[model samples]
Each structure stands twice: as C-alpha cells, then as structure tokens.
Target: MSTPVQRLTAEVNGITLSYLSQGEGPLVVFMHGFPDLAISWRHQMKAVSDGGYRAVAPDMRGYGASSAPDDPALYTQFHIAGDIVGLMDHLGEKSAVLVGHDMGANADWAMATFVPERVRGVVVLSIPHKPRGTQPPVASAPPRFYQKLFQAIGVEDDDLHRNVKTFLPAIFDRLSGSSEHGAPPSLMVPEGKHFSDLFEPPSKTPEWLGEAELAEYVATFERTGFRGALNWYRNIDSNWWTAAPWTPGHVTVPAAFMIGTADVAWALFKDNGVIDSQKERVPNLLDMRVLEGVGHWIAQEAPDEVNDLLLNFLAKLEARDS
Candidate 1:
C-alpha cells in the first residue's frame, strides 16, 4: 500500500505549490525532477516521517498541481529556488533538510548555494553538479539532443501529448535497472524521428511502478500538458546566466549524494572531478554512495537502501545538534 499523504497547497514566491506531506517533527523537504511528481518520494516520505521527521514533497514549480506559468523564463534556477525558500517560510520552518532527484537535485543544489542558512542539509540523487559552461547549453549540443530539441517551442510537448501513457512509461522503464529492454534510452532524437521515438512503451512498466501510480502520472500530464515542465528545459541557458554570481559558491551544509551505478548519469559523474571535487566544493559532504546494479530511479528503484541512507543522514544531523 502507498503511504497516506496529506495533499496541501502553499502560496510561495507568488505561486501556489501543491505538495504531498506526511508525518511530523523536524522538517524534511523532497523535490522531484522532470516528468515526476511529489509522490515519487512516497516511500521515503513514509520512512523518514516514521523516523520522526516531517516529510514534504512539493510538485515543483511547473509539474503536477503546482503553478505553471507559461513563460519559460519563470522556470529559471532563482525562480525555483525561491519557491523552495518561500515554501519553507510558509511552513514557518527555519531550516529543513532538502532531498531531491534529477531536476530536483538541480534545484536543491541551487537552494544550498543561495540560501545555505535556510538549509540544514541536502541529499541529492543521480545528478552531481557540473560546472556551468560559457555559452548556452543548447549552443553546443546537436540540434536533436533532447535538451536542445526541448528548447524549440511546442515540438516535444506536442509529441508527448499524443500518447502520454505510452511515452511516459517508456521513460520510467527505459531508464530503470530492471528494464527488460536492453540499452538505456537514447537522448538524441535521430533524423526523421521524434523524441518520443526513443523507445516503444512497454505494455508492462518496470516493476518499481504500480498501475495506479502510473495512472496518476498520466492523468496529470494529460490535463496539464508537457509545456510547463518542458519549459524548464527551455530555460537552461537563462538558468546558466542567473546562476553566474554564485558560479563557484559552495554548499555550506551537511550533504550526501546517492546514485545507482547503472543510472545513465553515472557516465558523467563517475570518476570525474564531479564527485571527487564535490567534497572540496561542498565541504560538508558527508556521504556519497554508488549502489551497484541500481538505475536512474534510485529512490523508487531501491527504496530500502535509499530509506536507510536518508534516515542515517537525518540521525547524524540530529546528533550534531545534540
């Protein structure tokens, strides 16, 4: 059974964010990434909340039931980070541990950089920080690279909107460690092919996903469409600019990074200066784990391991205060 979550909304940073919240005690915020919802953290929320922490998972600025401003500009790093800080203020929290995955990892890292005081600590999954590049990210990528393609207006959204169930499950399944289909989903859109052509949607989703859970994901996207979420990709270049003042700023808080070795992102983070230098960059980095055979969906794919890591980090934070 899924954890029973209290659905709530907060008016933050001039927008309303619908979030899933469970349990009580010290605050712990979970943020989801692209094409994901707050419920992505359902397992962790229940575990952390049971361990005596308030678990709050916001749908993020442009996904799920949250505010989805049409302008791509609103999805920049500052906008998303402020939404988090503003949510904290709305909840009357002085400081809270932030846990995030994918785009959420990106946003959580931004929060730590801009407002470390409001952050007790951060736990990020999959994505490790890459140094900001000089030109717009899209400038260097080939036209069909997924991120570059998303920069153009309406193409990807229209493609995905045609078949949410098919494409959505393909995303979850193709990137999973237990995926029956071999080879990770390609991010490049080949000539004469749309982004959704990356893989055929499996009739059965990866084991980690439930039919009901997937239904909720499909329904939400069907109603909201993908423009708002895809807009985040659209603003990558602007986000790069907005983040300039704090280009090399460090996260001055206790932190942990967890990823499955099989996650597609491992190709970028593994043995690269990203992890080794992350400790130097984020001086308080306390844990970095590479769980073998796991996949991109680290939290959902390996809940038991992720729960242990989250609780252990939370306990360590409590000990520091003691």
Candidate 2:
C-alpha cells in the first residue's frame, strides 16, 4: 500500500492554500491546471515521494480546497508567482523543484521567471513556456477559441452547473488518451458551444479515473462552482500585460517537459509557437517526452509511465544539485 498523503494548509500571499504532501526531503511543488484539483497529481505525488523526494501539490488559487478570489483580475501571473513563493516561505524552504501541468504549468513558468533563486529545477506537462506574442493574448486568439469564449463569463458556469455530475465526467473521458475523442475541438471553445455541450459525457468513468475519485471533483465543483477557475481565463489579457517585462525571458533552470500526443493542448497549441520555440526559450530543457497515445490527463491516464518519468527527472535533479 502507498503512504497516505497528508492534507495541510499554509497561510500565504494573504490566502490559504490547502496542499497534499508526501515523502520527505527537498521540496517539489506540483500545480494543477484548470478544471483540475491538487489531487490531480495523486499519482506523481506518490511515486516521487516513494522515490525519496518530497512532493507537494496545492489546490491553486482558484480551485478545490484553496480559497478562490471573486475578481477575475486577481488571477494574474503576478499573483500566481507570489502564491508559490509565499508557499515556500510558509514551509520555511528556500528552494524547491517545481512541477506543473496545464494552468499549473503556466504558474510554474511564471514562478521560474519571477523567482529563479527559489527554483532548483522545473518539470512542466502539457503547456510549454511559450514566449508572449506582441499582441495581447485575447486580442490575438483564434476565432471562437475557448479562451475567447470564456471572456463571455458566466457562459460556461451556467452550462456546466446545469448538470455537474453528468458533464464533469465527460471532460475526463474526452481529455484522456483512452477516449475515442478524436482531435479535440479548439480548446476553451471552438464552435461557441456551451462548455458542457462541447463534450459527450462518457458512458462509464475513464479507466484512469475511479468513480469515487471523480465523485470528489464533481462534489467540489458542484459546491464551489467553476467561477474561480474560469476567472483564470478571464484575466489572460491582463496576464499578458503583467508578463510584458518578462516576455522572452527563458527558464534558465534545469527543466523537463512532457505532453501526450492525444492531448487537446497539443492539437490546439502546437502551431501557436509555444511548443515550437520551447527549446530556444527554455535552454536547460533536458528531457522532452511525447507519450504516444496519452491525452491531457497524463498523470491519470498513464500513471506508471508518468511516475517513471518524474522519478527519473527527480533523480537527475538531485544529481545536478548534489
């Protein structure tokens, strides 16, 4: 049996962040993306912890057990980088390896850029450290892009709120490698359909996600609503503005990146210049793995593979540090 993860909270950045921790040693913080909670890293946390490295996954600013701010403007990258650095201060640590996926990945990039001294190394899944374009993100977004659709605000929340239980599971199924969900439609929103309408709910829970595991997410969203999460997207343009001074700044720390071939992010963002220019920007990027058939839910869809990759990276990180 695996060691049970401990639940803890840190009062940081003027808010409380509930985080899951396992193992003991140097700190490694895992951040989850939109539509996901800290538990999303349950698999990686265990593997890395067992591999003899501390793993910490937090319910980021607008998700799950963490406090969610009401104003979308509060979700900027500046706030994100601060929360993480503050979390480290709360834990009394001076440095850590940062691991992130999706929105979590975005925050990791920001933290690495904003506070390089605090990062020992970095691991990112799905999203690469794409340098900012000259134009504002929202203004430059593709037609009917999901991120664009999100600017409508309350559109997705109203749709998903209609059937939290039914719609929530679909996102997991359709986003995983196991799903027959052919090329994901433009992420956030390609056709301008309601968030729930864009996906077909699975007939059964995905193999990687247990019904009980899914129940937790459903219950959480059902209670918290998707406002805090959607608010992240609402502030993309503002994030670009805050990111202005740091645009083109690369993550100089040792880094690794992984993405599933079937992930919707790959299909939608492949040509957006993030993946293409990842190497030029993230110079220390040591490993880049492409999981042949996995999707956005890399940790859940292929836990064993993800675990091995994380352990390998952690080992390399320790070697580099020592």
Candidate 3:
C-alpha cells in the first residue's frame, strides 16, 4: 500500500521548512540526519503510523524542499530545535514524541531540552544523549578532513555536482566501513591519507548502500545541495553556547537510545567512553541497548528490531503517563 505524504510550510528560525507527514493519532515526528530527507523514514513512517500514531517527518532547514539558508550559524542545534517546535505549532500539536537519527538526533537532544513540555518523549537512534555543559574531545577535535576542505575551498556548490558523478559512494562506503575487497590499488590508502583517497572506486559492493540507493542520495544532494547539511557540523560550538544556560541537562520525559554494537562510532570512540558519559546526562533514561549485528543506520539496518524497541518504549511511556 502507498503511504500518504503531506507537505507543510512553516517558518522557524527564520527559514521556511517543508515537511512530510502521514497517518494520524498521537503525533510522532521523525527528524532525519545528514545527507538525508524525510523520505528516509519511509519504513518507520509506515510502521509507526500503522501502529496508531501520526508519523511526521520534515526535510528540516537544509534538505529536500526545505529552505536552505546561506548562513552556517543558522544551522545550530538551538535554531534547528526551534524549527521543530515551530513545526509542531504549525501542525496544531502541543506536544509530540520526537524521534531522530544522526544529525537529527543532535537536534532532538536540543528540542527535548529547550521545550520539555512540548516533547512527550524522545527516541535517539544511533546517537546518545549529548549532555549540556560537557564538551567531548571528539566533538571538539579539529575539523575532519572533509570539513576542513569544505571550509578552506568553498566547496559546497561544486561538491554536490561532483558527488553525483564521484563522491557519494565513497562516503557511504567509508561511513559503513566496507570500502575494500580486492587489490590495494582499488581501495587501500596509506596511513594519514586524506579524503583525496576517497575518490577511488570501491573494490567490492558496499554493504550499507547499493547502486539504486546511492543514486537516490546522489540525486537529492544534487538537487538540494550539500551545504545546508554540512552547516550542521559547522555549528557545533554555536549550539553549545546557545544552550549554555540549560545545564544539568536531563530529560524529564521518557527517553531511550540504541546503537549497533558494530557501528563505526563505537570503533572510533571505544576508548573515549562517550557513550557512558552520554547516558549520564539523561536522568529519565529508561533503556539503552546495543544491537548485536547492526550498524549506524540502526533504523534502516534493523527495522524490525528498531520497531519493536520503539513500540515497547512508547507503551511504557503511555503506561507511566496514565
């Protein structure tokens, strides 16, 4: 059956956002991550809406048909969170369960903090609670190679064009950690190699994305441009400063987070203990689980398990509220 898609126009943080929502019941808003659109939640929208909750997903400020502004500062978590609240207001919803993944999860954290009354509950997938008033090293590290490149060369305008022709597959491969299979020349790069190494074609099929999937991503980036998405990364410090007053960060609403044990975030920060620190921030954290075989795209990678987790969490929250 075809899931219904609705378009909404609302002004938030000074930019108009275009969102897609379907089904109807208690409102549930889905916020997507970098390099993604509301369409990314096609499966979750169907599952959640069919389960009796209105499932709403937005293109946010930078992706899909949403307004994309030139100022990087506008993409900070504070602003993005405000956009969500504005969206709820536009929808005539006083409160909604907020669900987010990747960059969207970052915004979800801010939303739950900035407007507690407006968030019935929150679900963080592939991301943990980012405590207010705490600065983690990884988040503070010098910009990643790609980020530095984006800043140094003013690459956004052309990057999207090139990506459709060249870079999207590599990013997906690297993010999924499945770039190599054959000879070193086809995939391997020396230690300390920069993103220049990413230009090479993958030796094997990437486990996370295929040609059709990549084509979709490439087309979206091409149409929407990647700058708006990259702006999220650029506003890290701005987000912190804007959220400075709300310390002792704790979500009074029921909240849960889940990640794949094999996710690259774990591999990258295994020694940093960011996950444990993240858990400490949410006082009402009801559950935290690491799926055995999944990766960063927890929802897409393990939908059935993700759905089960969400359904149970929502049930518990409903019980508590009753």
Candidate 4:
C-alpha cells in the first residue's frame, strides 16, 4: 500500500504556493520545471517519504494552482529562490535537501549559491549550473536554440495557447528519447513559422507520458494560459543581469547533477564542455550521472532510476550527518 499524498498550500514570499507532500521527517522539497505541476514528482515524493523523509513538491510560484504574478520581472532567479527559502521558514525547517528539474534546476543552483546555509545538499536534473557566460545566452546559443524563440513575447504564447493539446504532446514526444516516438534532437521553431507550426501531431503519447498524465498538464495550461510560464523565458536576459554580482560564487554545498543522454539541452551543451565545466563551477559536486537513452523529461520517464539515485544521495548525506 502507498501512503496518501496530501495537497497543501503555504504563504511563502508574499504569495500562495500549492504543493503536494507525504510523510513527516526531514524536509526534501522538489521543484518542478515549466509546463509541469507538482504531481510530476509523485514517484520521487512517495519513494522519499517511504524511506522515512518528508517529501514536498511545489507547483512553483507562477504555475498550476500557485499565484501567478503578472509582471515578468517578478519571475527572476532571486524571486524564485526567495520563495523556496520562505517555504522553509513556513515549514519551520532550518535547512533541506533541494531537488530541482529543468528551470527549477536553475533555481536550485541559485538557492545553493545565494543561500548555501539553508540548503544542506542540492540535486539538479536536466540542466547543469553554468556560471555567468561571457556573452548573453541568446547571442551565445546556436541560432536553432529554443530559448531564443522563447525570448520573443506574445508570439510563442499565441502559438502555444492556440494549439495547447497538440503543442504540449508534441513537445513531450520530441524531447523524450522514446524510440517509439522517434522525436528530433532540436525543438527550434522554423525561422518564419509559429512555435506550434514546427511539430506534427504525435500519433500517440510516449510511454513515459500517458494520456491521463498529459491531460492533467493540458488542463492546467488551458485554465491558465501559457503567459505565466512564458514569463520565465522572457526574463532570461534580465536574470543574467541580476546574477552579475554572484558571478564569482560557486555552489559550495554538496551537489549532484543528472541528465538523460537524449536530452535536447544536454545535446547542445555537451559539445561545449558544459557537463565537464561543472568541476570548476560546482566545486563540491559529488556525482554526475548520465542515463543512457533517456530524455529531457527524466523524472517522469525514468522514475525508478531517478528515485534510486536520489535515495542513494540521501543515504550518503544521512551517513555523513550521523
């Protein structure tokens, strides 16, 4: 039998955040990426809770049932990190193990960098921490990078919102490494085309993502247009500017990074020494695990493997503490 996962709300950083939690022990907060909800971490949450730790996964500040601040500027790394810290305060926890995926991994890097003391250990999935680069991301990235397309406001949202159902599944299929779907490596929208115009309708949802699961994501985006989520992308350059002062900082806390071999982000960064560069940027990085034949949606696609890695990391931390 599985323990029931509870839905709860917290007043953190002057906003309401909806989250899912299970068990009642040391804090292990999971932060999910864009186009995903707290439920995305259900497998990990249950695994951790069953292992005698309290596990929590928040919908983040601007997604799902959480309060979405209209201003794009409000979605910076500083703001997102503050919300996680505030969540700790609300839960009366002095410190916690922070686990983040995708954009949430970016926030995990920020939290571990800016407020090292509050984070006992850190785990980032899909995205690795790259210290401030010489040039702006948009300029430095290849012309085909999706982040560039995402930077343009209104355009991406219009296409995404216009074809929510088709667009969402297409993204999952393409980004996933499932041989069944045969998705491409890059998700770049054509130069003169809309974002939704790039993908053909998926014949079926990938094994990692079921129709029921995709429906949940579709319903959320349908209720709350893609504006809030897109705002995260809009602030990319601004976040780069805000992080200038912390350029010299490194993730001093114990950290681990994991990514799927087939992840689009990894494919782009791997050639650029991004994965190897973690040694200098995250000096205390404990491990870097690359799962073969996996894709961007790692947690959902390989929950058992992800949970095992997380548990192994947690066990190491516990042994050290004891």
Q: Rate the local accuracy (lDDT) of all candidates.
A: 0.87, 0.84, 0.72, 0.85
Off by over 4 Å in 3: 1-3, 11-13, 132-140, 143-153, 177-196, 199-213
C-alpha lDDT (0 to 100) for residue 111 of candidate 1: 90
lDDT of 4 by residue, 1-322 (tens): 5578998999988899889989989999999997788988988999999999999999998799999888888888888988988989989999999999998998898888889899999988999888688777776777766778777767787778889989888878877888455645446656787766766667888778788889998998898878778888877788887778888668889888899988877877799898889989888888889999898899999999899889988998998889
Error of 3 at 301 (Å): 1.2
What global local distance difference test value does model 2 have? 0.84
TM-score of 1: 0.96
Best TM-score goes to which candidate? Answer: 1
Task: Arrange candidates, best TM-score first.
Answer: 1, 4, 2, 3
Model 3: how far residue 145 lies from native, Å: 5.2
Tell me the tens digit of each residue's lDDT in model 2 across 1-322: 4677999999988788999999887898998997899988988888888777788999999888899988888888888888889988988899999988888888888888878999988888998788777898887978676777777777876777777888888888887878766655556554646767778887888878898889999999988898889888888888888777876777898889889989987886687666877889998888888889889988788889877777888888878768
Off by over 4 Å in 4: 139-144, 179-183
| Ranked candidates, highest lDDT first | 1, 4, 2, 3
**Which stretches in model 1 have alpha-carbon errors above 4 Å?**
1-4
| Over 4 Å off, model 2 | 188-192, 271-273
TM-score of 2: 0.95
Q: List the residue pairs that clash in candidate 1.
A: none
- Per-residue lDDT of model 3, residues 186-243, tens digit only: 2233445544355565665465555676677767777776777777767766666667
